[model samples]
Target: MIKIAAMGDNVVDCYLSKGTMFPGGNCLNVSVFIRRFGGVSAYIGAIGQDEAGSVIEKALHDENVDLARLRILKGATAYCVIGHRDADRVFVRADLGVSMFSPSSEDIAFLKDFAAVHIGQSSGLDDHVSAAAAQTLLSYDFSTRRDPEHRRTIAPLCFLASISGGDLSHDEALAIAAELRDCGARWVLVTRGSEGAILLGAEGLFEVAASPADLVDTLGAGDTFIARTLFGLIAGETPHALLSAAAVAAAETCRYFGAVGHGAPIKLSGVVPELQTISS
Candidate 1:
């Protein structure tokens, strides 16, 4: 089994339109998604030991995600109240002290045992949680700065870095990707939302269009896409397989409100029909 570990922000995502609360944060979502698809995933992140935290923890356990690395504090769990309409969601988040914990020495050692590790800059990085994984696949965020510690550690690792068009222009995105190649990542995938995503790989640049969908809430779609695509990569599935699976997962996310909607139930088998390979 390919052991996957994901570390990042953990939040109680409350969806106003759906009138529901779900556990989220890019790392938590990826970990749960991977576990649901038959991979062993360890979810490592911090949460405040409050009602919100309890709910989030139970949700993860219900999803069958291993939470041995989950950290709970006396403070309130990080939270986001999301309001959504068709294809767009606005978020109001709380930044508590819980975001300051990076993977401990034990956490780092544990992660090295996995086949791959995924970290997200959901809140951007500060001194604490930035670059927590030293020896695994990184999902780089262009909106977040690379932790100096992580940058040095990942210089020899294989990984993917991405930025939203909201964060960069096409030219700037391309330049930043090359910079990542210089710093460490083996590949860069610049996602331009409706414009689609561009993959800069050893095989050269591959750009693909967004799969068709009735846009509901774009929240969590990017995270879902990256999680499923990485699963395909680890499963030795074809590039086409990865693209399709990710597209389906992302499309599913848009059918409901908030980051995870009813779409969170998707498995690898369900995504095959939704995928179409674009010209490379």
Candidate 2:
């Protein structure tokens, strides 16, 4: 069976103000969503043999995501200190640790079992995996990175590119997606937190209003959206159907303090998904 891959970087998120910690990263969160939505999912990334890394590994294990390609090195694990409120957030500090992340030949060889790959924000990792997974559909989260040269490098590689508009107005969000389209994005998307999301494709722009969520920690909301979008694409769903599912999945993530179904005890309501059983 074809599995989907979410690989690149992950970090142990330290909620300094809240005195809590959790495994969090774009790719990791994407994997979390895949497993919950009943898709065969794989996570490919590097981690150290530290306590924090142990927690991350355990978390992934709990999610039932395949970790055969996970690299455990000998050093401190990547970590980030975050400060967030009921409605906002701030990154206090971060360290990438000793992880040198890039897909190995063995990892690429494993992609034959997968149908799609979601590229996270690691430049080096992207450099390696994008070309290797050439046969698979590729999607990316732009992460509010507006640097022209950087966007140029990543844009062409994406079948769909998601850009964060945070709280931008309708016109503002459209502008961001347009810029990405100009930079060669085949499908451009702008995610606007609780407001909704906007998409720019061959048929022009479409908007998906945010699904209702009792707001919790907003950390993994965007990541969940990326994962949902990937799964929808692999399912051969239309863009309108895909974005609607993505919006629901993302808002569902917001109802809890972390990404859903990574042992979150959150039940997915609304639409029923029909993917394969999650991989162990």
Candidate 3:
């Protein structure tokens, strides 16, 4: 099994389907999907000590995830209030009372056994922790930056990058990809919801289009896509395989109501038909 370690925030996704709470967050969601797809995975992050945190921990256990490293801090969990208009979700975010930050060298050391270390883009700000974790890092942060210092900070650590379209412009995305490469990243992937994904890998630039589907909540689709993409690459699958699997995962996620559901494993056979390959 390919051991994978994910480090980032654990969010209590409150999906307002006539005002209801739901589970979500990048690390937790990705860990769930990675395990479902046969990767040995662990999540290193902090949560709250509230009832919401309890629910999240239980869900992780029920998902058969290893909870040895999940630290529950005394505060309200980080959350997003999601409003659904038709099938799309609009988010109201709150970062208050979440776990305080700490850079864990031990967590970094533990991730060395894993093939890849995935850090949520938000966690990229925790450069010390991310830089200590692994030589090969995949960052899910896609904020288009105008600051050169921020670019310098992120450039050295990430090997591969995943960003949403809303996070960058076409030209800006290309520039960001190049900047990340200059900073040390080997590949950069920009995700455009419904349109597809753009990749800057070893061979060069390529675009992978999204599979057609009835859109639901696009909550954790990016996280799910990134997890599966890494899984395929770890499995020795080709770029086509990685892109296909990622697309399928994203599509499956959009069929659900929250980020947690995006991690459901779809068979390789199930994704092949809906995928489209692009030129490098």
Candidate 4:
């Protein structure tokens, strides 16, 4: 079995229009998705002492994701207030809350036992990337951070790097993928939304069309792709097979309401002032 650790960032996505919230954040979603794929996964991040934190804890526990490294801090949990426009999610407000944290030496020691560690752009662990990569394969989600210099700096340190190119044209996506590969990322996956995805690796470029879905929400689809693809790589699957499977998993995620589907009624009064003021 592939065992991995997801370090950094956790948030509750609040859909104010629908008065519902879901546990999300790239690292958190990846950990949950890995477990759903039958891999052993652990989450390492901080959360607040509020209801939002409780909600996240419950969902992670229910999914059987290891929370041995989870921290319950004394502030509000990180959150993003979302609004929908023709079914696409739009962020209206956001707060980092207690989510920004660096892994300690002991945490890094524990992470070395895993097959890989997954982190994202929002995960405040950029300084620790080199150290962590030295001990285990590191999977990074660059999301929409497409600065060439930034990619050049971090790509060489990542075993597998994923980027969100959904907004870019086919040529643009291919260009960025090639750049990341040239910068030394052993494997690179570029997701282009409806245009499907492209993977660049040792064998060369491989493209796969996006799988069909009912399309309820597109929030966690990319994260699903990243998590599944990473797991398949560790399991020794071919690039074509893994990307194809990942596209299907991503489509499945689109059929749900939240990142991993544990939705709860939004309690504005219990959240931070920024969230509470929005409802009023």
Candidate 5:
């Protein structure tokens, strides 16, 4: 079986307008999506003892994602307050809380058991990327980070590098993918929202148009694409076939309200004093 580990970052996306929250974050979403795609997946991260953390835990548990490495700290769980503007998500506020954490030497050792380990820009584990990559194939999500120096530093360590390029033109996105490829990433994928996605590797460039969807929310579409792409790659799928499958999976995510659909009522009063009074 294709086994993967998603290390770093987890959060509850609080939708203030709807008074609901959903478990999210790039790594977390990737883990869940990998499992949904029939891969053996594990999640490694820290959460707080708060309600949001419980929400995240339950969601992961329900999805059957391995959580043996999950940590429960005494603090608030990471969260981002969101609002909708005509089906588009708008971030209103956020706090990292206890989400940021580094893996122990033992944790790094554990990573070797998986086929690949996925980490993201928001993961706060940049310093350990080299160490982790040494243990297993590494998949890194740049997530709209365009800093040349940052890309150059990390791209070389990745087996597959993913970027969110929804705002960039086709030429711009392709250039970024090539840049990552030149930087030593075995493969590179750039997702361009409605414009679709592009993949580059030893085989050359492959492009696919976005699949149509009944638009609802776009929260986890990119993460879905990344997870599906990773799954397809591990399954030895062709570049064009994987990109097409990933685009379809991403579009399916767009039809939902949350990353993976386990939502609960959000109690703003329990979040933080300042958040309680914020208008939806």
Candidate 6:
């Protein structure tokens, strides 16, 4: 089985509608979808001891994902308030809790068994895991970096990268991806929401048009796309086939309510005995 370790932030995504919560955050979401696609996935990060943290813990367990690396702390759990406008979501704001969760050498050693490591936009954890993931394939989601310093920092670490093209045109996005490659990324994937995804790497540059679907909450579509793309690559599918598969999977995620909802969350009681002693 393909083993992948996802290290970084985990957030409790709270919807503004009725205060409904979901387990999210780029790396956590990726791990869920990776497991859904048959990969042996593990999530490595710090989750708070609050009620929201319990929700995240229960959700991960229900998804059948490995949670041996999760660290519990006393701080408030990180969360984002998602506002909805029809089928689309608007990011209201976020309180970044546990955004600074960086694993130590022991944690990195545990991740060495995985074929690849997926890094999230969790401040310093990207750099922290890059060294540990050196022997393994490392991929990161840069989100969108308009800052030159941030772009430079992203370079020379991860083998593959994913970023959102906010308002850049086709040509502009291509240029940006090329620049990212020059910086250090072996492959640069630019996601353009409904437009589709453009993948630029050593083999060649290719574009995958978006699959049409009934839109719902766009919470974890990008995470699903990344997970599917990685799955296809691990399965030895061609680039074109992988890209197409990823696009379709991402579109399928929009058909659901929030990320991979395998079933209802299993309510967890009491503090995590093993995790309670750990500090943030």
Clash count for candidate 2 is 0
What lDDT tens digits, residue by residue, belong to model 2 across residues 66-89? Answer: 999999997767766666765555
Where is the poorest 10-residue window by lDDT in model 3? Answer: 271-280
Ranking by TM-score: 5, 4, 6, 2, 3, 1
Residue lDDT tens for model 6, 1-280: 8988788877776653543567788888988998988889998888898777877888889878899988988787777666778877777766777656767787888877888888866545755755765657888888766665776777567667888775678998988888888898777888888889988888899899999989988878888888888777767788899899898888999997766653323222332222223222
Full-model lDDT, candidate 3: 0.67
After superposing candidate 5 on the true structure, give the runs of residues whose Cα lies further than 4 Å from its correct spot. none
Candidate 6's displacement at residue 259, Å, is 2.5
| Candidate 1: 10-residue stretch with minimal lDDT | 271-280
TM-score for predicted model 2 compared with the true structure: 0.86
- Candidate No. with top lDDT: 5
Q: Candidate 4: TM-score? A: 0.97
lDDT of each: 0.65, 0.73, 0.67, 0.91, 0.92, 0.77
Runs of candidate 4 with Cα error greater than 4 angstroms are none
Query: Per lDDT, what order, best first?
Result: 5, 4, 6, 2, 3, 1
Model 2 worst lDDT window (10 residues): 271-280
Candidate 1, residue 137: lDDT: 57
Lowest summed-lDDT stretch of 10 residues in model 5? Answer: 268-277
lDDT of 4 by residue, 1-280 (tens): 8998999999999887778899999999999999999899999999999999999999999999999999999999999987766656677889999999878888888888899999998887888988889889999999999778889989999889999988999899889888889999999999988889999998889999999988888999999999999999999999899999999999999887889989998877876557767862
User: Against the true structure, what is each candidate's TM-score?
Assistant: 0.80, 0.86, 0.84, 0.97, 0.98, 0.89
Q: Count the backbone clashes (under 3 Å) in each candidate.
A: 1, 0, 2, 0, 0, 0
For candidate 3, write residues 1-280 as lDDT tens digits. Answer: 8877777767666653433345577767878888878888877778787666666777778777777778878766665556767787776544534644564667667666677777665653355535643444454454333466765666566666666665566787677677767777667777777778777877777767898778877877877777887777678887877898788878888886777742322121322111112111
